[model samples]
Target: MNPAPDPELALEVLTDLVRTDLEACNRLIVERMQSPVALIPQLAAHLVAAGGKRIRPLLTLAAARLCGHRGQRHVALAACVEFIHTATLLHDDVVDESALRRGAPSANAVFGNKPSVLVGDFLFARAFQIMVADGSLRVLDILATASATIAEGEVLQLVTQNDTATTEEQYLQVIEGKTAALFAAATEVGAVVAERPQAEAEAMREYGHCLGVAFQLVDDALDYSASQAALGKTVGDDFREGKITLPVLLAFATADETERGFWRRVLEERDQSESDLDRAIGLMQARGTLQATITRAREYGARALEALSIFPDGAERRALAGIVEFCIARAR
Candidate 1:
């Protein structure tokens, strides 16, 4: 039997791969932003300058390298991935009325909602232009489809917001569309550009879908568990906005009418107290909702690793698998 793969070997490969991608991100972004339109350059630079984990771009780069691609298109594709992500964030902050992101004021907050939205449009156009430059109709198709799905997901989430009756399954579908769709496209496009085999390409897409699901799971968990200092946004911000995330949904499912009423009042009326947030947390803890939510994340992580079998065992495959571990490890 091939013994279980050592995580350390995976970690080493993942760390090195991610580091190389991050190092190259700034230069590549700048080089690509030399548009004739000055505003496009300015807006793209502003969003790119606001540092993120660069996880999406790294996923593309690493997947390409894993599939044996050694071309400059990987760099441009990575930048396109990040541009799409940033554009979503800019629009999200506007819709959510969010004040903070990644430890800084959201673009909407700093530059006003008008500029933020317009700049977001600029990024989207540039992303499309970059994809066109790649000369791959397949890549453009995946990204365009993912972009539409993300937009639809955002609207779906808006409809669900402040509706206490939003089911867990509904929530999952929304997240899969809004979050996992882009992640799936990012890695899958990498494989496609590398001319990977059909089975391997499908596996890479599944890998990204599962990783994205796991990553969003921990984002919900952290809202309840982490401090404002760590989260860079207010703790319980979801509750404040009446966004019923996974943990809360799980807890509410088992909650009695009184507890349900409590949530209804908070969500529908937006009339929450410190005590409301505290009691909600208490109930979730007592009922093991956090643990239950974590269970779901682990299941997704397992599926992500399971999707890697199509790729032959190698450092690239190891690193791709390690990313799943990183996602789940965030909760612990």
Candidate 2:
């Protein structure tokens, strides 16, 4: 029998399968990101040229192909999805005061925060222009709502940050808004523009949403997993930033009085010593909270696979399922 699918190979295959369409999308992204004001394009290019897996736009392209779309609109729409995602990244780095992204200096670090924010705004406007050009009101509505939801997610994250009292449900809500909303929009719009049935569109949305949640869950777990080089960020970013992630939440839930007080001091009080992150990892491991977080991520991965059951068996479906595996495997 064939061995279990290699998650990395699956993603590489998916990238190759949609390469032609991805090239078209890239061209459109380049065209749209250009501005008469030199600084706008320069700052935007700083982030856009950074290497990434380009998963969001790939989802759009793959979903359109999965739905058997015969038009060229998917290319532009995929670029639009990318613009939204990139804009969010710029804004996020500024808010998080992040220095690195995709293993390189973040746009906000290279360009000032003001320029990063303004360029992010430009990307948002460009995304809307592409959507309007597509002339699909349903697509517009879906992506527009996702933009607002992302903002809400960011705000919710801000409120929950440094608050050890944040619940798992609340944390899920934040990720659903910030990350999964765009994923849902990217895939759902592919179906929408393909003129697929509403039920199929909804299924695509659910698939993307579940996949995105699993993706974020793994990211959160990895923050404390001592694999920051693979993650392309500092190992203790979430901890230092006092973002209450799943592992921390689970750890706090089961901590003894002393450990509970420790969490409160480090996270709630934002008072961390140099050794705090090492201690945090030790606590999470001893308590199996990191493993538990991975288990939770796998649960979402399973749901993501389930959502794709509505689609017929095909390479696209298999690759999509493989993405779920890849997300969970990252934490392992």
- Which candidate has the top score in TM-score? 2
Clash pairs for candidate 1: none
User: lDDT score, residue 105, model 2?
Assistant: 91
Q: Per-residue alpha-carbon lDDT of model 1 for 1-332, expressed as tens digits?
A: 12125543544556576576656765767787667877667766666676676778888988888888877687788888888988899899889898988777777777788878987887788889988988899899989999999998888888888887899888998889889999999899889989988887898899999989888887888888877766776678888888878888888889999988987888778988768888878888988988888889989988888887777787777778877776666666
Q: Estimate each model's TM-score.
A: 0.92, 0.98
TM-score computed on alpha carbons, candidate 1: 0.92
Which stretches in model 2 have alpha-carbon errors above 4 Å? Answer: 1-4
Model 2 scores a C-alpha lDDT of 0.89
